[model samples]
Target: MLVSRQTTVHPVAAPPLQVELADAPPPGVWMNSPQGSAGTIGGVGLRLLQALSAAASIAVMASTGVFPSFSAFSYLIAAASLQCLWSLAPAFVYIYALLVKRSLLNLRAMFIFSVGDWITGTLTLSAACASAGVTIVIDNDRKICAGNLCARFMTAIGMAFISWFALAPSFLFNFVLVVTTFASLLAP
Candidate 1:
């Protein structure tokens, strides 16, 4: 008689590195990328507005030659560079969506995202104005008044409206989506 041995087989799992890489797919669809949607386009555009605002502020500061730094030009560049980070937020959001494997973003979620953009945009715009005010003060424009507060407030509100405008199309898109989603859910 011959003795027979039993054999067992186990499935091998992917290596950790491979799994990690598989989880991190590059997003190719426009839905996740800034170029795919209007909201992101607006984000990039508004970021340009902020950068220009920052640059204008730096220019004013530089023209005055009032900064007490050894290399005033360097400081101006530094200040402008700091504001340039806004240009990257849209790309960052796109990457974040990619990391989550998000292909089709929900409209309501887009609306919520717009709200976030609005908050950030308004805050940034307000800060830009305040920075301009600070620069004015630094340049010895001591004609300070309660009017400046009103001016800043108005500027922020105006900028907030622009942010709202940026969100408007996306907001409508989201509303349609939300209604459609609900309708689909309710359909027999």
Candidate 2:
């Protein structure tokens, strides 16, 4: 005799697994964070302004056709050109950071940025001041500025000043970041 066994299969239902993903940091939080200002929108804007003003200064001075005669004007052109290139490099990096929604301000980067800003800011200020002094002297003398040369020189000086003004904030911000970073490292 053969015996047949019948078996019934039962299905068990398991609870669904829930996964929690971390949300991205908000703009205000990251923008104001001490990580570094170089990656922020405002930082990028300031850099662009500096670059544009510096380039404008170079262009205006070049158009004057008399900058080659004055050592001060030549110095201004060099400084402005340097400032433009420097500002542009950081602006590009900041723009990339913004696109990826990331901050580009590590400790090393902050220190480097601080140093660069200081050097460029000093050079820009010196160039602007020197050019301004020369321009004033030329303006005061009727023989030197008989044409529109003085006016063009004045405009270039103004642009250089604007570039330096924009650089000032960036320098201060980067300096603060470096100081805070070092302080935190040395803290108990």
Candidate 3:
């Protein structure tokens, strides 16, 4: 008897599975920060005030021919000149940030600003105080106001004080920005 053997076949196994994932979120802009827009605008305003006051001080001091005789007055002019330059850059930066509605108060920028503010503020205050002291001596103790020189000197000192006042606030504001930047970096 011839018996036909039954044919057995097994089906092929399925292919291995694969899973697809979504892309990650995009990174934020470098200028963007947690600091508000008002802070930037205020900073610009403060810097502008600083520049203007320092310029005024320089103008008033330089206008008088006798100012060259006094080293303190000359120091005031030099300090105010340097201060104008230092404050102008930050003013422009702040204006740009305000126009873009972003914050430029990053760690590096703020640190630079803080150091600049400290240096300029100290110089400005010292120059103003020295000039004021000299003016007081000439006006009160020495009684050397033959003409209107004393008046002009007093005006210059006043302007220097105003510039210093404006710069002090800007310096404080920079520190606040630094703190904010530090906090942001430490955040999860």
Candidate 4:
């Protein structure tokens, strides 16, 4: 006599489910998020304006041929130089991002942009103020204001102010991004 054996089969277990964080932003949201005037075209425009104004400031001051006479003028030159570089590098990145239809508003990038803009803006403002005060003092002395030298100094100061103004919006936008990102991360 032959005996037959019965086999039992066990069911397989399902994979665990993935639970996304409730506070996490949706994918691509940062890409299309509002950045005030720091959006693609706006960012490029602002950066270009900043770069142009800063360069113009430097050119005007240098054209005076006597900028070396005052320490304030030297400081203005250094500040404007920094502002020009800061604005130009971002302008190029904005241009590339625009052409590629990509967003450059990542957390790390925005933080860096915010800090850089703040530092550059502060330098520009301080330099402009110092230069303006020096120019005013020089203008009051008829002996120093004999020519158009003071006028040129005034023009350069104006350009430095303009550059600072152009940078304001970008700094605010990036600063907001950094703050909000951190806030969200810390929130329950």
- Residue 36 in model 4: lDDT: 38
**Candidate 3 global TM-score:** 0.76
lDDT of each: 0.46, 0.86, 0.83, 0.87
lDDT string for model 2 (1-188, tens) is: 99987697688888898875455565433335532278888898899999999999999999998899889999999999999999999999888988987766567887888888889989989999999998888888645786788888989999999999999888888888778778887999
Whole-model alpha-carbon lDDT for candidate 2: 0.86
Better of 2 and 4 by lDDT: 4
Q: Write the per-residue lDDT of candidate 3 for residues 25-136, one digit (tens) a residue.
A: 2344343333322236667778889999999999999988788888999999999999999989888888876676555645888888988999999999999999999999
- Candidate 1 per-residue lDDT, tens place, 4-32, comes to 87698788987677344543434533323
TM-score of each: 0.34, 0.83, 0.76, 0.82
Worst 10 residues of 2 by lDDT: 27-36
In angstroms, give how far residue 48 of model 1 lies from its true place: 11
Worst 10 residues of 4 by lDDT: 30-39
